[model samples]
Target: SQQGEEDPQALSIQEGENATMNCSYKTSINNLQWYRQNSGRGLVHLILIRSNEREKHSGRLRVTLDTSKKSSSLLITASRAADTASYFCATGRNTGKLIFGQGTTLQVKP
Candidate 1:
């Protein structure tokens, strides 16, 4: 398994619905971060949850981390059509590098 890999490959939802995505990592990590990438654009950091923290939230985004299972989940509340993008999970290493997940493509319909 890769260091940071996301499940469900892709997801589609109607506007105003909630979107949930999951990620799993193989090795130990200091923190896990989520990023959103629009088509043909750079990634935008969404949230970062430390190993010691169980959960964190930023506006419409909610993240949950489970160090025991080596997994994390991202929840986007009240999703909008503009929210369509690819979401990736990144494992923060001690060496100041991040191992990114394969990413989950989300399509929010209007």
Candidate 2:
């Protein structure tokens, strides 16, 4: 998101543990999105929350955005080995341009 920095570039957690990733951006955004990418595959959009929204959830995934801080976080609950992937946050502006974060690699061990 806006060429933001993601905390814990790499993370390893147990299968049942929850995984959390944080991203901080440099500028304002219209909306923010989280994506997941498997080993060598393309990114899959996980969730998108508008600037007006504070939080959103999908299944075991929770996403929170703080426009005030220009930051966001993604939380994966009850993580599984299959959840192992690289997660990225992308910020969209009124100009229709999207800037992505460096991404956080999560490894869920069985």
Candidate 3:
């Protein structure tokens, strides 16, 4: 079953500050992915960290996963107004099924 939740349903920050979002899942996962959706647009893949991995980074995006705790966090450093979007964390299982979290809406003001 898809069971996940992201903390801080909404966040507001100034440009250049960092934004962090947390996600918690109820089951084991093969891999975890973070995505960004700009308003009405499709989700843009941000980063993916495997079950064996504890942390990963892509450009200004950083992701950390704790399988034992069944939780993950996404951090965006030096956030920009353009970074304003909804962020989601999805868990992928051995069956190739992906379960998504509710998402965190971020607003970066300039």
Candidate 4:
């Protein structure tokens, strides 16, 4: 079953601005991870927050998880044109099946 579902579906921002995207999932998760994709190809692992964790940050990326709410949010600070890509939230299962969010497309204009 598809669990992680990203909101808005798309986003646009200017360089230096901030971009925020959200994800909502169905079942309990062991760990939630964020990924970035360029031109709809390949996935770059951004950050991962465990079920026991509430929040985490890595460089320009910040991730928050609320297992109680079965949701997560991703924030990108100081956005750059290079940041133009699609962001997705993924749920990891002990079964080794990784479910990915639909994705939020972000276009950072320079």
Poorest lDDT segment (10 consecutive residues) of candidate 2: 1-10
Candidate 2 achieves a global lDDT of 0.94
For candidate 3, the per-residue lDDT at 24 reads 97
On a 0 to 1 TM-score scale, where does candidate 3 land against the true structure? 0.97
Quantify all predictions' global Cα lDDT against the true fold. 0.94, 0.94, 0.94, 0.91
lDDT of 3 by residue, 19-75 (tens): 999999998899999999999899988899999999998999999999999999999
Q: Which stretches of candidate 1 lie over 4 Å from their true place?
A: none
lDDT score, residue 109, model 1?
98
Candidate 4, 1-110: lDDT as tens digits: 28857886999878999999999999888999999999948999899999999999999988999999999999999999999999889999888888998999999999
lDDT of 1 at 30: 98
lDDT of 1: 0.94
Model 1 worst lDDT run, 10 consecutive residues? 1-10
Residue runs of model 4 more than 4 Å from their true location after superposition: none
TM-score of each: 0.96, 0.97, 0.97, 0.95
lDDT of 2 by residue, 1-110 (tens): 33789997999999999999999998889999999999999999999999999999999999999998989999999999999999999999998988889999999999
| Stretches > 4 Å off in candidate 2 | none
lDDT of 4: 0.91
Which lDDT tens digits does candidate 1 get at residues 1-110?
A: 46767987999999999999999998899999999999999999999999999999999999999999999999999999999999999999898999899999999999
Model 1, position 26, has a per-residue lDDT of: 89
Q: Return model 3's CA RMSD, one decimal.
A: 1.1
